[model samples]
Target: MAKWGMVIDLDKCTGCTACTTSCGMENNRLPGENWQDVLFYQEGEFPSGTLKWFPRPCMHCENASCVEVCPTRATYKDADGFVLIDWNKCIGCKYCMIACPYGVRFYTDEKAPIQPDVKQVFKGDGQRSWNPPWRAPDSRDDWKHGVGIQPNGVVSKCTFCYHRVSKAPKGTPDLNPANPALREFTPACVVTCAPTARYFGDLSNPNSEVSKMIANQRGVRLRDHTGNKPQVYYLTGGAGGAVPTDRRGKKA
Candidate 1:
C-alpha cells in the first residue's frame, strides 16, 4: 500500500501564498478560517539578518495526538495515512484543537460564511437553479452531506482535500491505475501549488520521486521530537534568505 506523503521544497517556495488562497477557495472555508496558513519567522541579526517563511497545513501525523484525544472520534486517520475530521461526528468539543501542537484545528462557533446572491445550478433530472443552501437556513441538514461551509457547533480542519483526491482522474502505466493499492493519491494543496514547491507521492516506494527527494534533501518535519512522525517534510534553505519573517518580508 502507498503511504501518501508531501515534500515541500523550501528552495522552490517563494511564499507567494497562492497555495493558501487556492486551498481556501477550493474548500469554501469560512472567511476567517484557514485550513492552511503561512508563518513567517525572523532569525540572525542586523546586517546579517534572515527571514523564514513557514507554510503550515495539517501535519497528518502518524501518531496524531488530535485523533488520540478526540472524545467523539470525530478526528481520525484515513487509510492513506492522512488525518481527517468527520464533521458529522464532531461535537465542537475543541479537544483536537487543544491537543494539536501545531495549532491547526479550528472550531466553528457560527454557521459558515454565506453569499446570498451566489447561485448554483445542479445538473440532471429535477435540476434546479438556486443559491447554495446554508446550514443555519436548512436547519443543519446540509452538514451531513458534501463539501460546504461546516455547520455550527462542529470542529473542522484540513482533510488534505480528500474529496478532490478521491475524484481525480485515474492512472496510466507510469501512474498505474489497475493496482487498487496505488489508489488514494493526490491532495488539493499539492495540485494548487503554482511553483510546484509541494510534492506528493508514496514515500514508501523507494523508486518514487518523493522518496528520492527525501534521500537527497535535508528534509525536516516540524516538532519531530514530539514523536508525531508527520508525513509532511520541509526542505531547508533557499535563495529567499532562509524564509520570511512577516508578510512584508514575504513579499520582499
Candidate 2:
C-alpha cells in the first residue's frame, strides 16, 4: 500500500550514463530506446553561463496525464500507484505520448528481436530442422512472460522494473511485502548509477528514508505548477544555490 517514489540528487549525479544503459539491458529494450535519459541544459549569460545535467525518467505522477489520454487503456496506474504499460493492449496511437509532460513514452518503428533461426547439419537428427520451441507457432502462448522480448506493436516506458521488484523477497514486517526493505528495491537505473545519486523508497511512510530526505532537502518537482503531482523529486544544490532555470532564463 506504500506509495513508491524516487529522489535524485543532482549534486551527486556526474552525468554518467550507467543508469541509462542498465535500464535498457535490464528491460530488454530495443537499441537506441532508453527508459531513462540524462539531459544537459545550458543557461545564464555568456560570461557566467553554466551547464547542468538532469536525469529524466518516468515521473509516475498521481494525476498521470498519459493514463487519462490512452484510448486503449494500455497505460494505467498499478496497484502500487506506479504508472505501467500493458504493451499487449496498446494500439500505438501515441495519444499517451502527446499527453505526457515528461516525454517518457516511446514507440518502436521496427520489430523487436525474434528468436534466431538455427541451422542444422544433415547428420543431426536425420536432417531435422532446429528451431526454438518457444518461437514455434504452438509454443508462443507458453513463453509469454519470458525475457528479451515485449509484445510487439505497442508503446513502452519505464515500469520501474515492476516485474523485477515484484519478484524480490519480502524482508520484514515494517516494510511493504511487495518490495523488501533489506534489499534496495531499485529500478535498474538506480542500481547502475555510478554516483549513487538516486534513492527509491515508499514515500507514504513518513519515517522512510526517502520521506525524510524530501523533508530535509530543498527538493522540487518538474513542472509542479501543472498540478501533475509527480513523485520524482530533485535536489539541485545546497540550500542557497540559484534555482534551476530553463534555456530562456525562466525558472524550470
Candidate 3:
C-alpha cells in the first residue's frame, strides 16, 4: 500500500484562492465552508511588511488526534495516510473539531458564515445539509468515506479528493496534474493551482517526487510539535513565508 502525501512549495504559491474555489466546487461545500483555505497575513511592520499566504488543508495526520478523540469512531486514519470521517458513524459532537489543532474540521449545523444561509436556500434532499443544483457524480456520494456534502449534524473536512485519488491505477507513484494521464485523478486544488505549488505522491516510495522533495528541499510539517504528524509538508526555502512560528495563537 502506498502512503500518499502532499508537498507544497511556498515559494511558488501566489496567494490566489484558486485552490480554495476549486475545492468548494469539487466537494459541493457551502459558501463559507472552504475545505481548502489559503491563509493570508502580513509579516514585519510598516512599509517593510509583506503579505504572505499559506494554503491550509487537512493534515491527514498519521497519528490523528481527531481519530483518537472521536467518541463514535467517526474519524479514522487509513493505511494509505488518509484521515477520513465516516459520516454514518458521526454524531456531530464536535469532539474531533476540538481535537484538531489545525482547525480544519467543520461542523455545519450553525448559522452560515455568509449572510443568508445557503443551505436553507438550497435544501438538501433528505439528511444532506443542502443540495446544490448539480453535484459530484452519484459514485462520489459515499458517506462511508465522507465524499459528499455532509448530512445534517455531521462534521466534514478535506479528504484529499478521495473520490478521485482512490481510483488511480494501482501502484501509481504520483498524482501529478501536469501529467495528462493523471490529471483527472488528481485533487481539484492541486489541478487548479495556477502556480503549480502543490504536489502529491506516494510518500512511502523513496522515488516518488514528494519523497524526493521532502528529502532535498527539507520539507516541514505544520504544528509537528503538536504530534499530529501531518502528512502534508511545506517547503518554505526562505523565498516564501516561513512556517508559522506563533505557537501561542489560535487559528483565525
Candidate 3's C-alpha runs over 4 A off are: 247-252
Residues 2-74 of candidate 2 have per-residue lDDT tens digits of 5778888888888887888888666655445667877766666789877766788889999999989989787
lDDT of 3 by residue, 108-153 (tens): 7888999788888889878788888878776679998899878988
The TM-score that candidate 1 achieves is: 0.74
lDDT of 2 at 246: 44
How many clashing residue pairs are found in candidate 3?
0
**Candidate 1 global lDDT:** 0.66
Which pairs of residues collide in candidate 1? 51-243, 52-243, 52-244, 53-243, 53-244
What are the TM-scores, per candidate, against the unseen true structure? 0.74, 0.75, 0.95
- Best-first order by TM-score: 3, 2, 1
Using lDDT as the measure, the top candidate is 3
Clashing pairs in 2: none
Deviating ranges (above 4 Å) for candidate 1: 110-147, 168-185, 238-252
**Model 2, residue 66: displacement in angstroms?**
0.7
Number of the top-ranking candidate, with TM-score as the measure: 3
Q: 247, model 1: CA deviation in Å?
A: 18
